[model samples]
Target: MKAQLELLSKYSGTAIEEIEVLFKDNPRLQSASVLGVNIFEELKTQINKSQVLKELIVYINDNYSVGDKLAPEREVAEILGYERSTIREYYPNLKLFGYLDIQHGKSTLFKRSFEHQIIELVKL
Candidate 1:
């Protein structure tokens, strides 16, 4: 752990004292360290991007119909409490699954009913 901290300090330019303080402050980080896992990597893998996609599907199903125009990415991000980039990241997935039609310089449109796609998303 000392070696790991020293390497992290060397690469990140963060003092060992500051890194120790961060570990002391965040229980999750402390736990990850104790388990010999990289917390940053764990955090990246643990972000439920599919869950967010499922949520967007449900939101579209509940609020919009086929051919109906959807809000811009920024507005949808605000409504969903996610970064616009995150929402945009999943737009292609939605399009591939036949739920949405995303076009450059145009509002996204509901391409089809996503009620059935919810089950598919759960399997992902």
Candidate 2:
């Protein structure tokens, strides 16, 4: 467990500190140090390229779990390293991708699709 955190920490480098600050709120992540760091670090990279949503798709791929509640667009924005409005702006398209099922300010997901050809819509 510690070793996994260490490897994940390696991926964060300068970003570890930021993730640590966010970690305080998510105690379940106490031992999994690297996961949050990697998420934020990778998110920054993705947002810069306008591929933030795709990055989230990849994230759900790495952490496969259904019933994920993507709410508080602020948090989703934080994960994507973008503004909350950006998530709203592209939300319909996200729904079209089948990764997101949004309604009434709540976002539910079918993460399995992200496991394969998730963002292949652009290619098609």
Candidate 3:
């Protein structure tokens, strides 16, 4: 199912953070994620559960300029190659993993620390 942007929440320049990031892997998670750089963690992002996910991350970094309002889900899906539902499924897990603010209904405001960490994760 496709997503809409009418439900977006206002941004308040908040820098959200999550302190609970587990190195353990779940069966439900993509294999690439589970097979990430296990030896030198703490700064890993493991973004390759699927190509769609990898695209989603890069799409966010490329499109959402700071101070630019969040794009609607429809636009996001086009760039991420994911159905809205799929992206939603990833959000809660990502939030727990350290994605700062999930704003504009279907968008994410990546945290610097999380960005640094997840960037490493995706690269792996």
Candidate 4:
């Protein structure tokens, strides 16, 4: 976890202290389940309650100006202590909401426009 936080800190210019609010805030990110299996609903619950998950979203969103690239789901899962399959299951929602895009042979990209929507959602 320490190493992952360090990696996240490296990716984002803001230190952990500066971005603590992002982690502390009650961020509720959700979407309709594409698979119709309630997986997203389950994962959203976890993400909403987990500071590490919220930090991952915020760190990527906050660091987007530096570059939109994101660490893959597998790496993020390792950091957040979730299964890669769980991360993979939740990815469709992220993509559906435009928070992330997966490119072949390239790192995922975080979308700032969608991130703005997320910020607005959090404000509500």
lDDT tens readout by residue for model 1, 1-124: 6866665666468898887778766757745554433543332243354678666766677778899999888998899899999888888867765668888888899997744424455446
TM-score, ranked from best to worst:
1, 3, 2, 4
| Candidate 4 per-residue C-alpha lDDT over 5-124 given as tens digits, one digit per residue, 9 for 90 to 100 | 344455456585644455445323111112222443444565667555555565565556534677777887886687888666756656664567777788877753433434543333
Q: Can you rank all candidates by lDDT, best first? A: 1, 2, 4, 3
Please list the C-alpha lDDT of all candidates, in the order they appear.
0.69, 0.56, 0.46, 0.55
Give, for candidate 1, the lowest lDDT window spanning 10 residues.
37-46
TM-score preference between candidates 1 and 3, better one: 1
Q: What is the lDDT of residue 102 in candidate 1?
A: 84
lDDT of 3: 0.46
Q: Candidate 2's error at 78, in angstroms?
A: 1.4
Per-residue lDDT over 35-63 for candidate 2, one digit per residue giving the tens place of the 0 to 100 score: 54555455345435556556655555555
Candidate 4 residues lying further than 4 Å off, grouped into runs, are 1-56, 62-67, 113-124
Top candidate on TM-score is 1
The TM-score values for the models, in the order shown, are 0.54, 0.44, 0.45, 0.43
Cα displacement (angstroms), candidate 3, residue 73, comes to 2.1
Best by lDDT: 1
Under the 3 Å rule for N, CA and C atoms, how many clashes does model 2 have? 0
Tell me the TM-score of model 2. Answer: 0.44
